[model samples]
Target chain A: MQGTVSVLTQIKEDAVATPVDRLVAATAPDMARVNELILSRAQSHVDMVPELARYLIDSGGKRLRPMLTVASAMLFGKGTGNAINFAAAVEFMHNATLLHDDVVDESDMRRGKPAARMIWGNKASILVGDFLLGQAFMMMVETGDIVSLGVLSSASAVMAEGEVLQLAKTGDVSTSPADYSEVIRAKTAVLFEAACQVGAISGGADTAGRQALSQYGLELGIAFQLVDDVLDYGGQAGTLGKNTGDDLREGKMTLPVILALAEGTAEERETITTALGDPDATADQVSAVVAIMNRYRALSRTLDQARVHARAAQRALEALPASDMQTLLADVVEYSVSRAY
Target chain B: MQGTVSVLTQIKEDAVATPVDRLVAATAPDMARVNELILSRAQSHVDMVPELARYLIDSGGKRLRPMLTVASAMLFGKGTGNAINFAAAVEFMHNATLLHDDVVDESDMRRGKPAARMIWGNKASILVGDFLLGQAFMMMVETGDIVSLGVLSSASAVMAEGEVLQLAKTGDVSTSPADYSEVIRAKTAVLFEAACQVGAISGGADTAGRQALSQYGLELGIAFQLVDDVLDYGGQAGTLGKNTGDDLREGKMTLPVILALAEGTAEERETITTALGDPDATADQVSAVVAIMNRYRALSRTLDQARVHARAAQRALEALPASDMQTLLADVVEYSVSRAY
Candidate 1:
């Protein structure tokens, strides 16, 4: 009882420091190595390969996925050093996907700056993406961990499939919530699942611990993506480094749009559809749609769904042995969801 | 003395049958399995994946890279069945490159049909290419052949770098023959080298046999690309199933362009430069450029360079144990260069 109370008190005190900050601090030395591996691996004799890769790699996104890998490995208190390679590979895979995604989505901005594709053109984006993926595999192979390589490679294929499906579903007003679930799972959660699983494997975890970490990562990823989708409509512009309503403009059938479509009146649905995929959709038009969404309590319901997944993520961590890292990981999941508020 | 005479006589007797025909017949059984594996691995729940993949796979480009893998493996007569997976993976990597190439080059025709990017947009081409590449690594990982995976993954990165280099050099009249060599080696030769090397490793080859096959494939690939570049200007339209002058229009600084730029008169240089990257350059303009190339013997010189590579390929194969497959592979090298004439 005293230990439990002490842990609770410590967590409450540490809440002032964001979970990500705490995780970053705890995993700082390991992450420095991962970051170094990532930058060095991204390098090539071809100047554009490094230049375009750096444009994206340096343009800030929270290195959250790789940090999860590092933290998961640290959770077991085993230091095999393979986790650094896995973490770097995970980041490479993520950046590769981003480079290609900007091309596929014809996105103009990423991480608050002009997309790499816009600067280097789509051809460079595609080839550099391939380079990074190749580098990712090379890093994994160098570690001699074929199992982790399989996890990461399989996750890569799933991510591409997800992108293709998302492309097919774009501007598709009839896209169901089920289809959306499949898209987000393949595109987002599987990498997280693999990242954590490989980290656990590198950390010398048992089968049960591996499974628990995998489940936790998957649930957290779902919650993370769900929050991202909601934030696209509701997030402050500076907060995300991307314009709000970009998803709606891209005709992405995200949860908010899907829910709003399901619950809106005929005229309201007409307004939503009109603004759904129109790139020239005005701020007034977006606000109008948001008003309709609010009227239907769509955004709140979506966040509610995110909370369910977040809770599931925390519940997954409960299966692991109690430790400060485990608790911090759970807190990270909570932080991921709370970003929406 | 009698044995040498008989072998020479047998080679003469076999000359009537084309080397590719003989090689195809010899490796038919192995290649069939490789083809089956390729088709199966290319399948996806997403309809577009299979549809687009098959469209390119079925379009006849001679499946040469995978065939090289199969033949190299057969040369050792040790059947681990791992060659089939490696062969399929080589094909996937090749196809993925083609898919992305069409998008990057903005090509209209591939193997006499419209490019995949034309039917499916650039986004599909990019995503499907990533999918195929993912499938390729997945196949390699499944074999647990980390050495071969390392080879292919490294080759994959080199290929991408070559492409980025080529993109940077496009339309640059200052591109040297050395630069051209670097481009072809990175883009084309490295994959050939890897395909054969991995096949040798899978077939239980020693270090020497592996090196011999790697050298053979590299030289053959260089010859193959040289002939390909020459054919873009000199071959009959239907023979190659692609229009001549594509490289010129696409601003590709192939050997002919570089040589013509080096040897042409000032006016000739002007004419070549003007038609170099002009997609809408008329047939007469292309004829004018070809006329300049003829005056400088640029096309013949390129083929001469190709023959040099072909001879090198045959020389490399001589280090291996003499077999019908070896003789047939050498003949294929001859056949590849002979296409330019």
Candidate 2:
């Protein structure tokens, strides 16, 4: 972890030019350590948990959480032990959530491969997910940092609660933007905020620094989620890991449709409702709904809002010292919304 | 936990003959400590994890794992801190399983009241279950007892595998008895065996002592599960915290029904098929199945096998020194079976 931190610090010193290069340099070591911990801890047994976890972890995924942790820590300095451990911890928690999410959603694909539940069965996915969550909590305890434990636990609880709320709201087309925001805050932003805040703590930053990083992460996460929702319509179905209209098929009311229903012309809103209202809504219907959103620029408008939040995330990081990690943090804000299929 | 364990130990002493008094008295202190440690650790979190734990722990349960830990220590006469910790560790693992189970089973009642999922929803139950599992791992790491960790982890993994297997077999009357046994061993017996075997490690028991305890716990667990199946068939729902026909309703094939289906008269087998075969079998159909089970004496025959296993468990305890905890262990075998409401 220390070596990883040193590499991050070196990146900050050597290159502060392009956002992508600086970001890659700052986050690569942290991501490597996170992956190492995951591989080592997850390899102890091959019976079920390890087998199932390997199927998912090996599935291609960008190490977003660890990057945020490293970036947050770099707000002060990159060479911090706390930052590296927390990075690993956040990734563990995120992976655990993914495992459970697949089971709950009855999803069959993720990250361009069959989901853990699809391959291992819901039972294996659920149990292995539990195992990983336990592992994450253990990691947090190892830091002997009570505040970190408190923050992470609270965030996890909120995440689960948001899931419950979402479950209750399924199939309802009346999902408001506020409700969408709450769900994102609980399900997505909380962890993002926690990752950054934990980084701040590791860097010996004050409460204000912690809050700023947390806000930055929260905004970034929301923007990321918005883009994901947008891509569900615009991106190719095969690569997104599920059917493009899965949200409609599974009764998931994401932001793009919600905005269209609220503000689109009546014909477009009707089109959106027709697709969302049908439990077994067809691809053509879903495509029609997407086309209607395009016609009214509802999808584009939502992207604009996401970009605003992304810019806010960048401005928040501007308070940090000029360094490669800081530059990377700013770059991630843009990347969050500029994601491609 | 200490209070509960000591009270139970006194009951064991009073229940057993003079032969077992010394063992119980000797084991009481460690059990007491383990109970305290587990309770403190389990209930320490005031929010998510602790809140859910208290709901279940205070709901009334026999702290069997901690008792096993202490008894093994006393029987082996090894004084070390590790044993008590293992005792607590096993219980934590057990509780983690329970939390997830309630969610999966969609059980409303636990210990005569609404279950964790009933009050908090499946999502909370699932997430909190994740939290407890993680906490257990955290606590286990504290002991630095690798053997115990390996045992707990393996048992946990197998338990999950068993659950998955059981799920696969649901609503299928053609499930073989061997498959049922495998599921049973994975789901229940492994943990019981693990709890006792880890106790042996703490007690400084030789290979023979550990093997005896391990086998004893395994047999006891089988008996316990058999009894549970029996109760599920005809016992009072109030006592069971679930409806009598929950298994049939949930499409589970237990030992009794499996045994009966293989050998019952053709008419009875047809009845079993009609009641359990259809994917959408109704409540009336389930009642018919239970009636058929009665005609075939499935409950009686199953109870007899359970009794045999209980007797085997008692015999397995012979090598251990006479003690109150030991007597309680013997009585537990009988008590679990005789628990029919």
When summed lDDT is taken over every stretch of 10 residues in candidate 2 chain A, the lowest stretch is A234-243
Provide interface RMSD per model, one decimal. Answer: 0.7, 6.0
lDDT of 2 by residue, B83-146 (tens): 7777777787787788787766666777788898787666667766665565566566667665
Question: Following a full C-alpha superposition, what root-mean-square deviation does model 2 have from the true structure?
Answer: 8.1
Query: Model 1: per-residue lDDT, tens digit, B62-174?
Result: 88888889888878854348899999999999999999999999998898899999998889999999999999999999999999999999999899999999999999999
- lDDT (CA) for every model shown? 0.87, 0.71
Worst 10 residues of 2 chain B by lDDT: B235-244
Task: Estimate the TM-score for candidate 1.
Answer: 0.95
TM-score of 2: 0.64
Q: How accurate is candidate 1 locally (lDDT)?
A: 0.87
lDDT of 2 by residue, A108-133 (tens): 78987888777766666776676666
> On a 0 to 1 DockQ scale, where is model 2?
0.11
lDDT of 1 by residue, A187-231 (tens): 999999999999999998899999999999999999899999889
Best candidate, lDDT: 1
